[model samples]
Target: MIWLRKTRLILLMLRGMLICATVFPWASVAMRERLIRNWSRKLLKLCGVEVEVQGLAPGQPAPRGAMMVANHISWLDIYVIHSWHPARFVAKSEIRSWPLVGWLCEKTGTIFIERGRKRDAHRVLHHITEVMRDGDLVCVFPEGTTTDGTEVLPFHANLMQAPVAGGLPVQPVGLRYLDAATGEPTAAPAYIGDLSLLDSLDMILRSPPIKARLVVGQMLHPMSDNRRQLAGFAREVVADLARADLVAAAASVSRAHQVEAKGADQPATV
Candidate 1:
């Protein structure tokens, strides 16, 4: 079953590549975004993940020209967000070499940054500022690394400069993966700590259905010209959202377990 799923995902990716190569060049920007959103939803369904977006009205369009900052948990994070907004992303330069995925990302306007080189970071930041200034939405995982679904790591403030420089709004997006049945944070989808992308995919396919909960926090304006302060504020909002969701999910699961226990303790009605 897992292999079948993998086969289907690969085929879909190939189809995406073909479209990107043949159609995207001529397709309007709206057409391309619609295709990306549909494709991303399909990928999530294939992986048995359901996305529930909160804090956005049904059918509401994603914010334009805002810099979206999200806490990274897995490679699937991109697809999860794209399923909802189809925003162009800023990813590591290494992903530009990731076979099919890499080419697809580049074709879709993803900005790749070489980590660790101050000059390259500045170059990418400038490019991101220009893109945002043109009224295109761009998302960056400011955590600088992926984490398990349990926590949001400290954000790297460098990318925050794009919004600060462009005088754009920064939106904090919180993502959490949960067990569909138990509502607890799930590890199956986490792509942390030495796990290859293939391994992560296999884990997700083998696990039970997963729920990707995306919380869109209120947009923050750059109060001052300080990128670090803006990054810290965004991180705080994301962290609060994540922690609140975890507590709520846990409470719901506990209530469910209590109900089951109470029913079991009673005599059978036959």
Candidate 2:
């Protein structure tokens, strides 16, 4: 059954490649977005991940031309976000080496930056600002690297310059992965610590259903032209959302344990 699921996903990915090869180049901007959003949702379904969005309504209009900053945990973060809101993403140049996925991302307008190069940020920032000024939603994972979904990392403010240059508001997004049935935090979807893509996929494909919780924070207005300050403030907001979810999950687990203990204390009725 797992193999079947993987097969379907692989087929779907090939289909995505075909579309990217042909239709993407000639498609209208609106058409391209629809395809990307729909395809991303299908891809998640094949991977057994469902999205649970908070702080935004179904079909809600995202802030146009705004810079979206979010924590990164796994490669699926891109599609998970795209399933709801189709935005051009800024990713590391290394992703360009991934098999079909890299090509797909490139075809769909992902801006890749070479890590460790200070000058590369300026180059990428120019592209990001241009897209934002063109009224496109551009997303950046300022954390720069993937974590295990339990904590948020410090954000690099280099890319934050896009918002400051354009005077655009920044939207902070929080992501958490959990077991669908138990509603507890899960690590099956986390692609951290030198794990190969195949290994990560094996874990997710063999685990229980996963729920990706997305929390969209308020749009932050630029008070000063300081990118570092803005990045710090945005990180705090996103971290608060992650902490709140963790607290709620802990409370849920505690309640379940109490219920179990009370049941065990009672004598058998029949």
Q: TM-score for every candidate vs. truth? A: 0.89, 0.88
- Give a tens-digit lDDT track for model 1, residues 229-261: 677767777786665554443343344335434
Q: Rate the local accuracy (lDDT) of all candidates.
A: 0.84, 0.84
Q: How well is each residue in 11-44 modelled by candidate 2, as lDDT tens digits? A: 9999999999999889999999999999999999
The residue ranges of model 2 lying beyond 4 angstroms of the native Cα positions read: 57-59, 244-270
Task: Report the C-alpha displacement of residue 176, candidate 1, in angstroms.
Answer: 0.2
* Error in Å for residue 58 of model 1: 4.0
* Model 2 pairs whose backbones collide: none
Which residue pairs clash in candidate 1? none
Q: Judged by lDDT against the true structure, how good is candidate 1?
A: 0.84
